[model samples]
Target: MVAGILMSLRELRNIYELLFCDGVIVAKDDRRPQSQHPEVQGVTNLQVIQALRSLKSRGYVRESYVWRHHYWYLTDEGIHFLRQYLHLPTDIVPGSLRRVSKATARGRAPVAQSGPIPRPEGQTDRQQYRRIQRLSVDKLTGVELGSKPTPKPG
Candidate 1:
């Protein structure tokens, strides 16, 4: 599910880049030729419309009509989303696509050390197993097996 969402977001980002960079105006018709823009190269008109609709629902794109034809363009929110997606600072315009900053890069968060986790002193595997066994069995019966007194249930 997550992978699908990511793939869709990537496709949407590509479509946004094509529209913004190439000044391509997408129409409502699916019969139109695929985009020639490098970012959206080979992508069908239907796929582009779907991406646009998704973006529109997320407030990233807006639709306008001229005469009887519908056209799509990026909203301010859409531009902001694209900027953040590209890891470029909010202040920087996307016109210079090559320019990016390392501080705001969308890299993975820093992971903690990968060394073996330390166990509490005096609690070996055998002790831990016995503890778990006692809890699991005693809780169900309200008494520890082999014990003389019954535990009061709360």
Candidate 2:
């Protein structure tokens, strides 16, 4: 249980940095579809953002922006707490993305490359719905849910 929590904390740390930085250093570069940022070895920027928001709500960081998008940046208290918990250097910058894994055969993460291609925005809601339904998972009782998930049909 402790191990799981620690792992989650690390994930939150990575995400907090990623979102606060706005995909500038950790997210994939738009021009080079072939190149990915070095911070998260296998995880996508979206996953990191989600984890950060989850941690934020629990007060591990600060407010979530509460999904408000009005403000970001770790509180002084939060930075202090996180520095101790994550054992980070005192001068750590806001936009840093630490690579947690080694490169793959293609020099990018195998897992990151495994997801389906992104759909164009012009796709209709019904088409998007069907695509999501096709990817839906069975509801499991022990799992926690994210707030304001991209809604799906019940």
Indicate which candidate wins on lDDT: 1
Each model's lDDT comes to 0.62, 0.49
lDDT of 1 at 61: 70
Instruction: Estimate the lDDT of model 2.
Output: 0.49
User: Which lDDT tens digits does candidate 2 get at residues 1-82?
Assistant: 1212233545556654554443222233232334433566545444444455554565545432333232334655556665
Candidate 1 C-alpha RMSD relative to the actual structure: 15.6
lDDT of 1: 0.62
C-alpha RMSD values across all candidates: 15.6, 21.4
- Which residue pairs of candidate 2 clash? none
lDDT of 2 at 83: 64
